[model samples]
Target: MKKEIHPDNYRPVVFKDMSNEEIFISRSTVNAKETIEIDGVTYPLVKLEITSSSHPFYTGKQKLVDTAGRVDKFMSRYGNRNKNK
Candidate 1:
């Protein structure tokens, strides 16, 4: 708990998740160039690439990779060489 070390310019800021377009309002000392109006109030808008609402772990929306297709492709390209040796 240090005094005069923390910033004193805490203000309301809006964080917008770019991936899912989720907006959250919280107090922060970070600066932002863009402004947005929400619920008749204006707040500094900050754009983020990922947030809890859009994150794979939080939203439980994991991307499924086609591992079988990749295996098949690898086998097609090099499987014959192994069989000859």
Candidate 2:
């Protein structure tokens, strides 16, 4: 309800889900370093690692996303704990 409190740079931005390559457009003021053309129009592009479109909670399916070998690193560090038993 306050004037000049909200950002004035809100514009249509394209958000892409890297895991599934799903894209949707929404208004946002976030800065983007890329651009994407959809339907002959260019919009600021933002890449996301995960979103509701590719999330397990919304799709009811379990999925693993490993970007920095985190899963493998954790597995290597603790995967053999129960092997000796």
Candidate 3:
């Protein structure tokens, strides 16, 4: 351990999984632009596309997370190439 090497801004932050709307609290130093109140206590809100709770590997299920039509765009651009084979 070293002195004055760790960040001092560690605090409780709320991480929300956008796919399943699952939320959990953990201490972090990451900056957040949004806030959420839980149990009458306000905490920084961080939105996540996927987490262990909703991930395919952790949940043993297949899931497709498409944000802003990214998956669609990718499929359109590259998916058709394989179909001709």
Please tell me which model should have the higher TM-score, number 1 or number 2: 2
What are the per-model numbers of colliding residue pairs?
Answer: 0, 0, 0
Candidate 2 lDDT by residue in tens digits, 35-73: 999999999999999999988999999867699999999
Poorly placed runs, candidate 1 (over 4 Å): 64-85
Give TM-scores for every candidate, taking all chains together and pairing residue i with residue i: 0.72, 0.74, 0.74
Query: Candidate 3 residues 1-85, lDDT tens each?
Result: 9999999999999999998999999999999999999999999999999999988999999856689999899888998997898
- Rank ordering of all candidates by lDDT, starting from the highest: 3, 2, 1
Candidate 1 per-residue lDDT, tens place, 35-70, comes to 999999999999999999988999899975677699
Angstrom error at residue 27, model 1: 0.9
How good is model 3 by TM-score?
A: 0.74
Off by over 4 Å in 3: 64-85
Number of the predicted model whose TM-score against the real structure is largest:
2
Local error of candidate 1 at 11, Å? Answer: 0.8
